[model samples]
Target: MSEAGPRLGGRRHSDERSSPQRSLGQRKPARTITIDGEHAGRRLDKFLRSQFKGVPAGLLFRLLRQGKLRVNGRKAQQNHRLQEGDVIDVPELHVDTAAAPRPAVPSTLLDQLRGAVLHEDDDLLIIDKPAGAAVHRGTDVSAGVIEALQHLRPELPELELSHRLDRGTSGVLALAKTPSMLRYLHGLLRDRKHEIERHYLAVVAGRWPADMDIVDAPLRREEDGVVVAGDGQSAETRVSVKRRIGNRATVVDVRLVTGRKHQIRVHLSHAGHPIAGDDRYGGRAFNRRVTGLGGPGIYLHAAKLVIPKPDGADLVVTAPMPRRWKALLNSDL
Candidate 1:
């Protein structure tokens, strides 16, 4: 036998060098510059973008839009021109450290999904999003449902969120699969005649009559960016008590006739029955009770939503109670 001891063709080895892949978390340090002499008169954002060559334009623009980078120690508009001796603070952008890790869709949030099939056509998906999760990235929040969905559906390159949701409030959230769908959805949202129907569920801290209640209050931004107004622009909210949880709290359903910043929270607070766990608007006593019940997140959930469907049908979706909320409720209550 031609010695079968060493199978020459079966195995082979060679010397090779493989480079380590760069991680998404790797980031460059932010550059800061003092505004002096001629550069003082330029817009703050424009100046920063010029200084940071490779930085994304959208990132810089969003920072300016949110008033993160201030001019002369004050919030400046994107078009605000700078002046001499102005100190410009450019904060470093923290890259996503776990970008390399596979994203996960929490099973806890799965129960909240509800709605009618409005449009099933390719390149577009319209569904009502429950409250709590944000629509996009902001200073207070980083990732949301849209981000997770993108991770789940990575094949769709142009997927984008078409609207927003308040961190405490819930309602319709639309996603665009293509550029055309994005444009169309934006236009629809901008149009007032679309007659979108949005609804909410709230547990307030007082007794309310079983009748339709209307609140006409105005809102405006305070110096700290929190929306508040004694005599601001006109805003309206309609509410009805679904049931009385107890003498201490009432389960109310609200219909926002006009969308305003913190409209529900403020209106309910003004009504002397702020939503439970609403520390900002609710009274200290009520907030304390919520906290004692293992509280941190808001009690509000985007219970339901209804919007004009893409195929001339109505689309409605719902998000269920976060596990934490259910745990807070005593079985007797």
Candidate 2:
């Protein structure tokens, strides 16, 4: 569970939009951030929103137009995709002084999270996130894995999601314990450098061939949350057949080359093998058939993560297959 190659390791919005950027002289001091590989290729506006969670979009646009926010000491456009190593100067804005308190996470959820921990250390916590559970609470979700864990371990106030897995998918999600560790890991993942490897196990609705192991495709996200293959963002996935059921399904191991939203699902479907139980994609028939036969939820699981540590060691983390997978795969296969 532990190895060493190298070990290392917001908010609020105000809606007042009256020339917020013009009052820079009276505003708080600015801060500079160095862009890394993880944030490379993202729009300038989007990156700022991530940094300043509660800032209004209008205010951000004003800042960009007024030349208050600069990249590499030069004025940048709102749609400017950032490059790694670029330095950005950010101007401060008024944030709501009184923020809403987080709601209490159910004790039952906390117990589930406690049992889901696969590995934990001073800098990182790896969890076997359950299927159908969101990693962080959103508008529709009241409490999620992140909220529950924070409540359960009140001492670790800095615990945060270093990456994310889809709600329908389950398995090895990592949480960083410190800011430096978070940045270190994010840089590795974003750049795809330092030998960071991620592997997934999936059950798809067809018999995939071992020879067809490479899926190099670009993905574009639609307004309705659907991903299509075309000229959007470049993405690739390496897929190999692990096991196959008689003329019905195949178990696949997927290595993501580019972490686009719904990348795996879109790529597999494009290859004519939609994941089982994925209704949003093309697995409705397969989902119905499996549900009628008492199958599990979506058949995608983040099984393993191998990350390079600062000390030139490898941090290998693994999660056991979900009970639903074991129960169904064993019986069905």
RMSD of each: 15.0, 8.8
Error of 1 at 250 (Å): 1.0
TM-score of each: 0.59, 0.71
Tens digits of per-residue lDDT for model 2, 89-188: 7767755434435666877778778888888887788999988889889898888998898788766655789999999899999998765578788898
The Cα local distance difference test for each model comes to 0.61, 0.78
Clashes of each: 4, 14
lDDT of 1 by residue, 30-58 (tens): 43445543345555665565455356667
For model 1 the TM-score comes to 0.59
What's the TM for model 2? Answer: 0.71
Candidate 1 root-mean-square deviation in Å? 15.0
lDDT of 2 at 213: 92
Q: Please identify model 2 stretches exceeding 4 Å from their true place.
A: 1-99
